[model samples]
Target: MSGTSDLEFFNTQLRSFVPPGGFDAHAHLYRREDAVDALPRHVEDESGQVGWTAYSRALERWMGDRRPIDGLFFTVPKPALDRPAANRFVAQEVRPLAGSRMLLMIHPDDDPADIEAAAMSSPCVGLKVYHVYASRADTFNAAPGEFLPEWAWELAHEHGWLIMLHLVRVRALADPVNHDYVREHCRRYPNARLLLAHAGRGFCGQHTVEGIEALRGLDNVYFDTAGICESEPLKAILRTFGTRRLLFGTDFSVSEERGRCVSVADGFLWLSEHNVDWELSEFGRPTLIGIESLLALKQACRSARLIDADVERIVCCNARQLLGLRQAATNQTQVTYRRAKRLIPGGTQLLSKRPEMYAPDRWPAYFAEAQGCEVIDLDGHRYCDMTTSGIGSCLLGYADPDVNAAVIRRVELGSMCTLNSPDEKELAEVLIELHPWAEQVRFCRTGGESMAVAVRIARAHTGRDRIAFCGYHGWSDWYLAANLSDS
Candidate 1:
């Protein structure tokens, strides 16, 4: 899928990174070098952490799915014109398109107009303030539990701004001591909605195990899935806060953290491999890669799914809605890579048949289910299906009937039991008879599994973990062993 078709596929269904239910309200990005440092007159550390152009250079190189970046939450640390500089950098240089990329935090200590200027400056959707670590300005302070007053909160709230506040360690959402301020602001200006940075780190931090009951009914409160919390902690926060109130964030410069590292392990490599494979297919070079990381990323998403599709949607949507950027771009070829990513490791799941190498438009042949294989592509062409189904195991068709029927029979017969199914014996006999070279036979499922099992048999027979093959083989020592235990 490419162009508007690709964008449509991504926005509607093809883009799988978005959480299925709500949205990831918070996502931060590092501005490696000021995008617009036209005048280096005022450059400093507290201004902003910088990294990668809009392409997600470092991020995609790590997470495997940099293509879905909709927004970046960041703050102009300190500088006379840092905000203006950064905005110009992003708007004119980094991502000059219909899509949006933004930074929402306010450096309250600076002139307050910069705060409103920040809002009106770019296409940002909200405002963020870490009054303690980032700001700590006395004026924005609200009260006991309140840092920013009701009137101040209302100032940003009236414009439909989603506020992000870092309430250092205040965990109990309802704890009067910590929450009296929030109550005051919510009552005085119920409209000033706030997303607690670390989900009241100290209050609920120790008792995350205490769960949903602690903050069951707070409608205006929100939390970002980041900081001392990640993975399971993130899911818990989502549950306690609900998908609507939970957003996705990596706490800026913290992408080096374990969670960030793990998130990109597969996705980053996928993009790396996809780019290389593409060049290889066109120019005959290759991205030497194994499936472990890709499989790991899949497993990560899979584990999250156990909670509910909504969790996934929230993570994805939060980024999109916050930035107002569509997932798939009208002119991007990358969506093709994202679409075929699920089933294949590095988009192939095969040792040789690298599908990622082809252009997005060229992927139809590899897929057996193109809407029209003959005379339907407008140019009146026919395609010969080329995807090797599980290393030559998919002869009947992709999701074929006869093959599925036989497997279904054995599966229902209890393939794993005290006694093997009669069908297994019959199939083994037929295979041995078919190939006189097969003096011994073993039962296994999946081409990868079968090939690995065959290698084990070969080792037993010839005392070797080595073998040579003629065609595309999966997980057959030369393939599966490539993943190794390290994977």
Candidate 2:
């Protein structure tokens, strides 16, 4: 049965987040009778269908109390089904809408001239190409010729049509063949624009971002945010392309996370519900990702320090520009502290140095350079060392000339290697000599780790588990774990 969860969720929960006239860059409208006749009976959602009639009703339902959205609708062609029939269905049913646009589906074997005539007749803005079909779902990888064939490119290049390419290589856009094909084709035929579907359909961490980066310097290439809800990938797309080249898409009529058949409305709700930084561990820290997944993109933009203008461009302006409607122009401080906040949760290794604990808004979150007792910000603003220098780590003050020189000399002599440096033993001996009572000394990476090691050694020596501390110490699970039961 068709799911109403999508319709209800969007109208009530997600409706508020969607911007007015926001364009859905990726969407589909296909005929049900054609699917029933051409496709095998094994496919789900085949008999119980939502044709253009149902889709129209759902669109109205989706806009119940929210502003209307403009959609770039395409005909999802079932292979072996009549291409002309599907194109005619989309043109007849979807093209009449106020702000809707259409893309014609072109098969590899179809005659380019005939398809061009059909496209011109329907007046589609672009052409859709799918390498993987439901009938041969098992065969995912396809050679360049087998997928679209050289003739398809010739037609698109000749007509200067936008090719909505859903590539099917193993690594998707990251695949060498796929990358080479897209870069070469886009470069060779500057008139033909390639819109990589689902951020090149690379769902893995940083794979999509890195893949897009590999095809850099091509002005004809662009990407869409359809079916993508991951925080990292979205941030990467925004940061790399600067929201100008990223068109807002939801891969409607399909699941955002999976390619399996699903309700069109579910795709919208899925992205909204799963909006969050999913990479973060929820073991001990408070959840950083918000519950309202629909609001995730807006929040992510804010987290990335993107201004409102850029966010607007990403959600609506970019899509408008792609459709030749409208456009906007292209649009941090913090050294270690600022960077660590974005890349590493909790920012600093120790919680004591967290800027939030201090004057977060006014705190100088990062430093460009430091020498002696002076600190310089990225803006070249200089200040004298006043507060605890580096949270009390720099006892002799930052960049002490004599101390830095000695450290540099040791580094030149190999600071760390498989064989221990002479300084390790010398430092231990010096510590022992200074304490006199202590028989040996050990080194650790952080004060917290060293404290935990000391506690472990003490517990092992006494054969006891329970221990007491007087006042404040470092942050270690041994001490903080007890605080878990305090409240």
Local distance difference test, per candidate? 0.45, 0.62
Residue pairs with colliding backbones in model 2 are 226-249, 272-293, 272-294
Winner by TM-score? 2
Q: Candidate 2: minimum summed lDDT over ten consecutive residues — where? A: 284-293
lDDT of 2 by residue, 102-167 (tens): 888877767878888877887477788776542355546774445666776777678777788876
Q: Which candidate is the best by lDDT?
A: 2
lDDT of 2 at 106: 75
lDDT of 1 by residue, 173-234 (tens): 33444465655555555555666664443223333424334444444566665443224445
Deviation of model 2 at 143, angstroms: 3.8
Error of 1 at 473 (Å): 66
Give the runs in model 2 whose Cα sits over 4 Å from its true position: 1-16, 34-53, 59-68, 133-138, 255-296, 327-487
Candidate 1 residue runs with Cα over 4 Å from true position: 1-55, 76-97, 107-114, 132-151, 169-176, 202-204, 207-215, 228-232, 257-308, 318-487
lDDT of 1 at 231: 43
